[model samples]
Target: MDSTEVAKQENIQRMTSNENTAIVIDNENDAKFLMKATEMQLEKISLGKLAQQKGNSAEVKAFGKMMEDEHNASLTEIRTLAQSKSISIPTTVSEDSKDHYDDLNEETDNDFGKSYSKMMVDQHEDAIDLYEDAIEDTEDPKIKAWATKKLATLRTHLERAKQFKDKNDNLNS
Candidate 1:
């Protein structure tokens, strides 16, 4: 079957787990969350690279280029942290991240920039939620600490993305 079908089946199994379901939160779960986030960040960087290569304007191209640099660096940092804990991160990009940007590939020029900025804003918001929920609910110290820090970053990125969107809009108008 297709990936969507596989994902649905996985979700069903995840929801039906006999053990109590807990997110990767707190200090212990930090390793897992970092690995997962790294996967996502890497994909974001990939999208950014694509945007830079084919973007229509200077702003759009710069935005994509910057994301590639920043996200790749962020991924490196998180991966390093995970290594300290002997965690093995996945080598492949996440299906969710791929799907998120795959739909945006058709956009071009100013539209692509605006869309990307909005996407970054939305993604950061979701990341903040995930981090906050896990940090608040998990008993694991490692997960909590990591989530707390990550939440802070997500919030900052969300604001930055919104500002980028506003600037792009103003310039276009």
Candidate 2:
């Protein structure tokens, strides 16, 4: 009747389908993993939209579009996974993310690209760490697989973010 009950039922159903061999992992951990992943993706999507609109460089705008598109797709996949597991994830960005966005939104044109790229670099690093932790900690095969699959993309994003940051740094020097 409650979420935990719902999650337990779903897990039982899934396990029964895979041959009655009990798979005992903490459902709450899976839920928390999904929630955190969702929040991170939402923040990236919001910041990506902002970058596309206000980025001072063509590269920054293009990167923003890529982030928006890729992260949106990732978010959808995450949502589907959460639904299959009966786990609920947050639908909106977190307060920290919103505050960061607001601060970035106030940057001057000359500093916007640099600041945005730097934020992306930092956020992507954090995302990479999150996914790595998930992959290591999640006992559910599906959740682990999802984290593993996304980890590669997150790394690529970090590399791109670093490149953008380097370019911005060079421009200012």
Candidate 3:
């Protein structure tokens, strides 16, 4: 081939390689997001159930019920999406979240409601941040849409958690 033709062929090959690399990177990101999201959901469900059983306050128990139900629904949706994408989600919660669960399990009844409420506030805030980051980082349309859909619920959970925390604090004061 002539020098100009060789240069053209090399450029085409480079572009093709770059395109393949981009696809791989995008798939990796999608899998990571799915795994993280599933872990968070499982943790929320675990904590929420604990609160429902151990909470002293009616409001806290109600909030826990809400969290359990809603998080379960979100989990189902994400699992379906992950299956369609051929991604494997972890069946267990993350270690960090497991630590939180263990700590909450050790709380006394007098402290359980307040402690659980505060944890919910923190967890929901973290979840909102995670979803927001995923929405920004993901190139997949399905993942972006799932994150966007879940953001509204996460925000609502955060708001409710904060309200419960404030109310519990006021009661203690």
Candidate 1 lDDT for residue 46? 78
The model with the greater lDDT, 1 or 3, is 3
Evaluate all candidate structures by whole-model CA lDDT and list the values in order. 0.67, 0.83, 0.81
- Local accuracy of candidate 1 as per-residue lDDT tens digits, 8-121: 354445445535545422333554455557666777787788778777777767877877887787777666766675555555566776786687787776777777778777
What TM-score against the true fold does each predicted structure earn? 0.69, 0.84, 0.84
RMSD per candidate (Å) reads 5.2, 5.4, 11.2
* Candidate 3 lDDT tens digits, 1-173: 33223433443454456658777677667777877788888888999898888888788789889989999999999889988976667666767777899999888665887788888888888888889999999989999998999999899889989998888766652
Residue 68 in candidate 3, Cα distance off native in Å: 0.6
Report how far residue 101 has shifted in candidate 1, in Å.
3.1
Error of 3 at 169 (Å): 1.6
Deviation (Å) of 126 in candidate 2: 0.8
As a TM-score, model 1 comes out at 0.69
For TM-score, candidate 1 versus 3, the one ahead is: 3
Clashing pairs in 3: none
| Candidate 3 global lDDT | 0.81
List where candidate 3 sits over 4 angstroms from the true fold: 1-19
Pairs that collide, model 1? 25-143, 26-142, 26-143, 26-144, 27-141, 27-142, 27-143, 27-144, 28-142, 28-143
